[model samples]
Target chain A: MSHHYIKTENLEYSYYGGAKAIDDISFLITHGEKVALVGANGAGKSTLLMLLNALKFAQKGTIDIGNTFVTEKTAKFIRQKVGFIFQNSDNQLFMPTVSDEIAFGPINMGLPKEEVERRTDMALQRVGCESLKNNITSHLSGGQKRSIAIASVLAMEPEILLMDEPSSNLDPFSRRLLINQIKSFTHTCVIATHDLEMVWELCPRSIAISNGKIVFDGLSKELFYNQELLNECHLEQPYLAKIEQMKEAEKIRSAN
Target chain B: MENLDRVISEIRGIETDAIDRGSRYRINPASRIIVCFLFLLSMLTFSVFNIIDTIPYAIIVILLTLLVNIPLSYIFRKTKYLLLFVFFIAAFNPLLDRRPAININGFIISYGWLSFFTIILRGYISVTAAMILILSSGFIPLCRGMEKLKIPKLLVTQLLFVYRYIIVLLEELAQIINSVKARGYGKNKFPVKLWSVFIAQLLIKTYSRAEMINYSMIARGYDGDIKTFSENKWQRSDTVFCIVSILIIGFLRFFRPFVFINNMF
Candidate 1:
């Protein structure tokens, strides 16, 4: 089992007394693969991401992360291996201060005091938030909170990163910074997002889901070009892809 | 809606005061808790008729409030709402016990009135002391201090959650109220018919938000135990402060300082 490898088979989940959120989802993400899980709202993108990390257990299916199978017993171990960044940074950060927020995961993992301090500092620096170490988590701006949320999970040193709508509610600059940060990570990342431009840039492969089922699983370019699939999944083509299309059309017109 | 906003901001302000390092009072959290507990206990020991005797406790609370650099007005503002409830509870005391206790210049003061005054005084002192403790040492440190004092982890965790989530809850509530007002349902007062529906909606939203927060907590490898990055060490100043506070509290509990002062005057 290669580290950072994630595979889910026939995954299914349903909210209590509610409709199924995920149905028969199957995908294999190899080590260091950057994959985008895109779908319409109320689709299973978030649930699928949760299942990958075992934050939400599947009603019926199997999830394999590296060598460990995700079950109730292995959920703790799975969390250590997979770091989840929630869509709402507020929900992700609960600590009083930034340093405490970052150190929380490491400390909870029972790391030694020195190691916890080292990891907390390193994570703060990683997120370029060293100056915010003492700032209150709730008092921080939206971008700062999001960065700290990422740092908080990064402190645990997980092999796989699962982010849900990482770009939501962020300004342009913050979104670009986040994109660059995610781009630099070597760990396998599965981002569930509606940001098509982000998917075009960061993810080589994109998986589109509609009505709790996988509609398309292929390269991002192919998914973007399939207008019917994009419409069905409630996705817009990336602006960059549109630019490329216009450029191609311009060249053909000149040749004619 | 404005009141809710003020409440939230006031809570945040107190939280800021607790975590501020520039404040002169930096007593260890555990020592502050101990001193506060002793102060409250001493205040509680006074009988209802011993209103004058409770004066020393009130004075101590005022002095401590000044020492902690918290403004008197700020304390008054934070505790005024609570004091109103205390007033209601103490209002019955004067009505229930009408026996004459003190006579000054032939004007009679009933034991009930004295008890009422004493209850209000006690309420003010108790609340002021608690405010001082929290303002001196922030919420997280206070929880840590409580844990050090052998308080159960479950209770400490609950306290911390309530403190943290109160802000979130208030924000959620503010949004609901704003939306309601935007829809022009109630400009002066909330519509009575919408109360049940609004409350049910808030409850459902709160439950779902709680579920999300719980998931976030578990995703971060949270076991049953809550841990902190900063471990507070007991210091010499803490020990000295604790000893002096306890002695003062004990002296106030035993000696009637207000009566002595009155006699001298």
Candidate 2:
């Protein structure tokens, strides 16, 4: 009955013209786990993330979130439990103002006005964007818009979070703030990103996909150390991992 | 490209002014909408060549713009482009009707010219009033007011979505035009022959983007209805504002104040 895990079985999805976006992919992420989904462009990373919350349903497989299955009838319930932050902040934020954007999900879920207000305030505080509550959504800077988009999803209080390129187009300071915010979350998170450095610093596990298939899934260190696999998946070792390797070599050379 | 940027910035400015808390004329959006409706009705009641009667409505718009602290220059600038279209529509009037309608001293004025000016005046006044409504009450609040006033929810929702996405569409267009300009293809004029292709590409891009946006909305629990967070209550002041505005609009429509002034002259 726990609603904190996601399990997919042999999922497949193809666009109308018959190009497969996700081809026979499967993975399991348990409660409170932070898994980084890393892949090159067109590697189906976004498609898989959408599949997790029924934003894009699989044509030939099943996805189970905790004990509940993701189906047409259950998408509404699944969406409540799984919050999605789209790669483009503009697309995710449709409301006019920041407060309205944050309150949208909760309001749709039929929460009381007071509870919605509390959640809105809490989410804004969580993202450190309380000052932008009344600002127009279209007028926000890229970093502020990303933060508000995250806050909007966080207001729903979902048990699982699926973020697609959350740090994309953000400045260094904004990305660091986002990293800290993600690090503070206790919910199970599946982040599809190209920022391997973020993967090293935050997620303990990494899943690398290539050409609609998951090529590697294991500990973050293991993935970073496998240069062959990284190259095959169009990925590079995390900067932190490279630094650690260089430091170890330096220590050995000095000892010799 | 510069024009697009100005438009985008102008929209942002209007949004800011719409939500400004210090404006003295911030009434409930529903009341403001009703007043705007009545104002438009009164202005449209003037027959062709009855340009003098529109003066009172024009004064009301100017006074409201001043009361709301929106500069006259801003309103004028926003309505100028729209007035060009009005000019286009009214341009043929003089050509079609050459019969003289008035003689001021030695100069003769045709009915067509009078009608032309009257049409331009009416267009300017209507566009300015609408701009005032949006400036005084933000677009979202206006839609909510429409909903409260028994406008169909579907139409209101469509209006809200169109308003929200028009910015995105414009941004996309700017990007496309910028890229085209970078390639040195759109210097003097965007090649007329390529317009069809350009429009098709833009449509495709927007359609896909719209699909992605729809998916995001669905993921956030968007059902058929778009629920809002802020609900403005209809205060006693709103009722008073509505009553007084309707009364004034009624007087302007019925009394013919300009004719009395002319008689005195």
Candidate 3:
């Protein structure tokens, strides 16, 4: 409903014993845009997502999500607009069954039983969980669990979808299906993934992180070709991009 | 193929499980508690002329245990373990009389020991009956059945918490074992002191992890109790199941049928 979906000004967060997780980062995300957060393990991607949810407090600087500054009251506003997807969907899908997990958020919000049921159905339908309504959540495959996890948050009807490592551990086919699901959503999305192809396919903009700092934030293609930047930060240049670069060099050599 | 479909439906579908047979014996958990008392009291108050009384009650309780689906051995094992606390209860039955010579066959020995054996038999039978009731109904449906009978939500919550968290703790313990195993500490590599040391480390790790999870759950707007969305309408089958169990228990309790020649003894 509001203009700016998310805005952070010089945001900094440190874990216990003064281990900085997000070091002086700032960004404004507009509504209806998709951004990929590209980073290695311990690169503070999940930390930043946690801050957006008001699950973790900012140690320094300001985060304003939907006109509300990130504070104790931030939960009221942030939770309505921001839906967080954990990397291990296993944790999110905690209920005995799929429909139960989908209904969990709505029920916790204390909606009418009828409305909760309706929301549960609608959310499951959105995630193509029609045949799985009665299936126990634990029995679901890795990718299926991830889909249901997203559906659970969707039941709450949050405006922004912030996911951590969305493509991790999914088979190639399931990964393709997940990308399709992401493209279907109109909500503003900040997805963190190790899959370079996924970032290219699903995210128009990409930001790279290293050692608790945003090392690169640019258009996806620009970040892809920045070989020196990638090498310095211990990121392998995406294979497709490297091949393309080699092809370009070959073409130039032949022309010369 | 037809038989296979039937088999699959029976095993796999929740719908099949939901079907209810009409049961006259579908007593509320509170009523069931009263039933348990009536069962024990009537059996105790009845005048027994010989082995007929004791033998019949034992057989009836065994049948009930079968219906309850609790293994007889499981009941025995639990009772055996519980003997520590009640070991003195037997002494009172015999110690009050000190030592009286009792005639057994032809010889007379210590009468106190006979009293003690009676006490042990009585305790064993009583615990087993209770165990059968618990094992037959299972914990959750029993809780639901109790809830339907207007048992307070607070009491039901206690049962739910125990049912849920015990399993979670067990699973977490398993994961801790796996992570330790993955770190080059299998049966062959285990050091002498590490057993106690690892357990201590696990305690600390589980405590901190629990604290973190508590924070995360709170952030998700989890107030004291989580709501379960699915409260299905009780099937006719559930009613029938309850009824069938009740009828069998009732027949075994009050009726003095000499179907077994062993009952004569």
Local accuracy of candidate 2 as per-residue lDDT tens digits, B1-265: 8999988777666656677732455577888888888889878877888888888888888887887787889888877888999999999999998899999998999999999998988898899889878887888888888998999999999998888677767777888888778886556576677878778878888878888899989998999788886757799999999898888888788878887677789
What are the clashing pairs of model 1? none
Per-residue alpha-carbon lDDT of candidate 1 for residues B142-238, written as tens digits (9 for 90 to 100): 8889999999989998998888778778878888888888897557566677888888888787777877877888998877666886647798988
Query: How well is each residue in A68-137 modelled by candidate 1, as lDDT tens digits?
Result: 8999999999999999999999888877678888988898899999999999989888888899998878
| Models sorted by DockQ, best on top | 2, 1, 3
The segments of candidate 3 whose C-alpha lies over 4 angstroms from its true place after superposition are A1-4, A244-256, B1-165, B175-192, B204-220, B232-265
lDDT of 3 by residue, A1-256 (tens): 7653888998899988968899999888889989988877888998899888888889899988778888976575676667888777755655556877788777877789999888888888888887888876656898899889888888888888889888888998888888899999999899987788777777889888888898988888788888777775666767777787889989999999
Instruction: Please compute DockQ, using alpha carbons, for every candidate against the native two-chain complex.
Output: 0.73, 0.77, 0.32
Lowest lDDT sum, 10 consecutive residues, model 2 chain A, at A90-99
- Docking level of model 1: medium
lDDT of 3 by residue, B1-265 (tens): 3443433333222221221211223434444544565566655554322234455667777876666445688677667866644567766656565565666687764556665664555556678766654444334445665676678878986876565544445455666666776776545466769878877876776565555444445544566565665643566655565566566556655664554444567
Residue B84 C-alpha lDDT in model 1:
100
User: Could you arrange the candidates by TM-score from highest to lowest?
Assistant: 1, 2, 3
Instruction: Report the lDDT tens digits of candidate 2 across residue range A1-256.
Output: 4669999999999978868889888899999999999989999999898888888789998999989899998999999999999999989887768998899999999999999999999999999998998888878999899999999999999999999999999999999999999999999999999999999989999999888988999998899988999999888888899998889889999999
Which candidate tops TM-score?
Answer: 1
Better of 1 and 2 by lDDT: 2
Candidate 2 lDDT score at position B235: 92
User: Where does the lowest 10-residue lDDT sum fall in candidate 2 chain B?
Assistant: B17-26
